[model samples]
Target chain A: MSTLSEPPKQSFHMGMLLNDTRYRGYTFQFIALLALVALFGWMVSNAVANLAALGQDINFGFLSDQAGYDINQQIIPYESTDTHMRAAFVGVLNTLLVAVLGCILATIVGVVVGVLRLSNNWLIARLMSVYVEIFRNVPVLIWILIVFNVMANALPSPSTFRGDDATASMLLGAFAFTNSGVYLPLPLWLEGSIVVVGVFVVSLIAIWALRRYARHLLYSEGRVIPTLPIGLALFVVPTLLAFFIMGRPIALEYPEMGRFNFQNGIQVRGSFIALWLALSLYTGAFIAENVRGAIQAVSKGQTEAAASLGLRPGRIMSLVVLPQALRVMIPPNISQYLNLTKNSSLAAAVGYMDITGTLGGVTLNQTGRSFEAILLLMAFYLAISLAISGIMNLYNNSVKLKER
Target chain B: MKNSLLLGAIAVTGMVAGAATADTLQEVKDRGVLNCGISTGLVGFASQNANGDWQGFDVAICQAVAAAIFGDANAVEYNPVTNQVRFEILNSGEIDMLSRNTTWTFSRDVDLKLDFLGVNYYDGQGFLIPTELGVSSAKELDGAKVCIQKGTTTELNVADFFRVNNIEYEPVPISTASEAQQAYLAGTCQVYTTDASGLAATRASFEDPSAHVILPEIISKEPLGPLVRHGDDDWGDVVRWSLNALIAAEELGITSANVDDLAAAPTDNPEINRLLGTEGTLGEMLGLPADWGVNVIKANGNYGEIFEKFIGENTPIGLARGLNAQWTDGGLLYAPPFR
Candidate 1:
């Protein structure tokens, strides 16, 4: 009887009038949205007016025009006469190449250092700690400069390194290091090698599927298989078979020493190598800290419980710790990847012929289209960053812990 | 509230009036200084000395402009800009004029809306290779790794030269001249390509200058000059004619040593008298004093004097005035009549 009466008494007060306090919150939110929209609209209008005053039009039609420039160290086929759009495509591909390579190398280095820092050996742990602290504290720009300068100044001239029978010299034959750049052997592919590559890729996919199936079998039936040896066999068998079947199609093209320098081999300019190494090492140091923090966040009790169940130390780590820690590690790691991609624009400083170096620097100066060029550069960076974040979010969702 | 609104309206009107009356010349005069943009550490062009004083061929031009405007050459602020940022700095109105070694191109003049004053240096793209290459000409540099500075015409010229010659070459592009030099020295590239003057400057800084040889090939013409923004025709004329005065003074043999004497007494040539402010109102036409040209010549000795002091055969650059010689000497450098 008291509960029923209390309900009616509360309803009577609720029906008295409309609430002004709740409406005030909605009014404030509406004002904030309007202010933000107005600010953006005003900015757009100002930009249009300024461009008009300067007799410049904001259009992307120039993207289809000839680039009329050459880029060094291209992984894809590009010529000086290619369209500007195509040139930017090449830049995007190069940027992805560096970012992906840097991410892989950084992850390996970070994991090793992170694990070593917690090792039982004091010397090893302290060494890794020192490395992390030193690299993380220094600005990446200084490291890039130091690496580039030392590589340029301390390397040998090609003339000194060139010889047919050159051995036991400062560097290998047809190879030299200098403050300017580095010369290395470039691989020349023989004809009909695509078949072998296709076979190799297919074999890799088969091996991956097999491993997954084996893991599933182990989980359901409590029966374990030797996955490592089987996977190795699966990889080697197909690759070796394809090589023999295709008559061994790939060949190495060693740099030949000419009169003044090496010729006919790919050369990695010192700037590219130095910048790539600096970005990787600096970002790796921060990644090491993130990895260590993530691993430590996993509860000790989980590991102990696994140990009580008679599981091996490696198995305990693989089954209990890593899966949990990866959830924590991935978000920060994604940020590092984005940072590496964005920081690649610093290639402009060293003249690596990246997008920023070509379109933003030379193309802008040569064409005098600053507004268009800068806008394109900004869009490129933003798209790359957003793509990386989107992929990382998908991975995060896949690995997230589920609870009932 | 009404009173405060009235006060705000009055303040807004006052601010608009103030802006409407603001002229660039008056602003610069009131500031008592002129901002000049220059390149970073080019040996004969623009470089700072050990005592931090900026001095070079381009620095002399900046000084003359300041002298023409303020009557005091020291009333100038030097802003060092890199090749990548020079134009942007000028476009943003961060500097009054860009006296850097910028190439005058149709795109820059029309598309960028910049007014190029006049050519200061007539340069050409060339190749520098180690002497041991035994390559006598650029035609033999097939399959060579050529180090090129990015953001310059050198990159385009390299590709065109190789393409037209039907030769295949690998390009090793870099950003700064110093980087290109370092790469060429390091054996990262078989050849370094840039302006002939830049090649000479880089070679002069090397310990073994004799080890390298500049290839005898002029691939493309690079007429380097100073530039100012568009929309300010008055300012543009002042800068353009100031450069013209220096060149004309060189042609007339009117240098700093004899500028005063010439200014005091009339010359037999009518054009000389007008140039020296003794006859016509050439300076007055540009809204300057009658003796503005004389002041400019007095400030920096003449184009010839400035060139000899900085990059002549006696200097480390040791550049011969081959194509840069006066029109009378069969070179391309020619100034219009002062009148």
Candidate 2:
């Protein structure tokens, strides 16, 4: 190693912004930052001038005004006399509902397809490949259209299910499927429903405790006790006993067929069904690939080692393969969930009253406040995407590998 | 990095603000093309033909304005816009005039600061339903599933109508007119509601047009016209009179065939002579040639001829001239005398 005894005499020069080693990065960054500011300032000034010329402003006062329109699918109470902001809130709720539902469904479908594709059964594996290929290659928009069309056309209209001797009948005499929507028996919460739910939750905790006790017995005592049956008993007995003791607090209101449609039940619009199903199926194909790759990434040696230690194949998979593969799979899976959430904005195509369909679309048109509406819309999407990633990141950290 | 990104955005916005700003008329003259905004594919209003040319009732207005300005009907470029972006596209100077079938509401005209030239079509909100449903009148439409195009006046109108009548209805709001039509036909909604003219235009394209019947109740008035951005009086006058010239031509019985001949020689009637540019300097006041009236009429005949050619009873749209006829004929179409 050469010992540097003395430093060269340094002089500040104007060229240091580009050529000097020590101060160059800061100088260059400053210059770049200045250029960017100038560019951005120029564009904003231009937009303001343009808006002024057009005799408009970027005001957002329209949110408090009465929204003269009505929304078909609103989770919250809304009327035509409600403010535009309330209408938008309803839209936000609808968007969240569909996004959450789509994510859950997409994950389930993706994992199933992924595992089945790697199955030893040749026919099942080939079928899974075909399903993935067909869904992965087609555009999500076309899939939405196709699914929406099927829901609208293939289903029988309510008039066909009207009479007593009607050709069309409700599923299980409780659910009605029509071109308008899928109607199901509405669940009514009674006086003791809360107690029932509490008992069920307690039963879940009891099952977890029972499993721990089983592990303790295995460690402390030489005799092994079968835990599955005991855990099942712990899971069901308390919930069932509480439900009966509470006199079956939850009652279902079955749908009654009317002249035009089924009444006295909850209805899910066909648009919602189509959008939900299409988003799940389309995103599932991509996630299937992710899951398959993650599983394959786990080495054969680990499974073989578990087998040599007298572990069953199922035990080896649950204890060794899944735990490792899940760590590799989680990060990509979070992104797929985010993708499904964002793609739910396409609900406008099928007339689902999501946030985009209501606020970004109808309200923007009605109010003619495109600048403010669009800015708010972009902010909403960014917030939602960031929030989702933030949550997933927290979950990911918990499941991450801990190296000693 | 974040600061740089923010600065970059500001710089881009500032650049856009510094973009070319000039008199729209002079810009049009310099560019030698009239940037006309139109709908993408509304059947009889603005759609591309097999020959790949934009032709419809709305397209004729654009061509007439271009003819009056440049003395060439073909000196116009069509920009297809959706309902959500039409106003921004016009306000941004991307288009010179919007000849799309936009309604002239009080808010749109005064609040949005747009100058509506003249009403080209007088329409009202109406309901179209499949005849198999056995519903005759709109009053019987309680608990109905209605399909409507979002971002339109019809959405609010239907809601008001239903509420005032103490009825409950579910609205399935689609984004595009085509989607609404598909939803209606596929029995997703029992009733499809829109402007009477739009219903005609949509029904005319159906495979079985007779299967649907339009309900009798007319809910709201929708006077659709061509418009331009406010604060440009010169450009506004040019577009307004170009439309007026068509109406006046129809009123005075001066068609495309007779406009040139009548402009060549003085006419017996003073109004016809003045309209044909043989009696006054009307065209000069709006910054056009002496033969502006003649060019406009010759570009797309008279308003009557355009109406007959596009949405008239003779066409597939098969619409009768109800409120669009002349004032003397007990219709609402009245043009100020070109003195």
DockQ of each: 0.52, 0.51
| Residue B161 error, candidate 1, Å | 1.7
Model 2: how far is B325 from its true place, Å?
A: 2.3
C-alpha lDDT of candidate 2 relative to the true structure: 0.87
| lDDT (10s digit) by residue, model 1, range B1-339 | 647865785686565445433455656778889899987778888888899989888888888888887778778899988777787788777888899888888877887788899998999999998897788999998767788876677788888888788888878766677777777877767898888998898888889999999999999999988898877778888888888888999999999999999889898878779988999888778777788888888886888998898889999989999998999998888988876
Q: How does residue A262 of candidate 2 score in lDDT?
A: 75
Q: After superposition, how far is residue B272 of candidate 2 from its true place, in Å?
A: 1.1
Candidate 2 TM-score versus the reference: 0.91
Docking quality level of the chain pair in candidate 2: medium
Which ranges in model 2 have alpha carbons more than 4 Å from their true place? A1-21, A163-167, A218-247, B1-21, B48-52
- For candidate 2, write residues A114-143 as lDDT tens digits: 978998899999999999999999999999
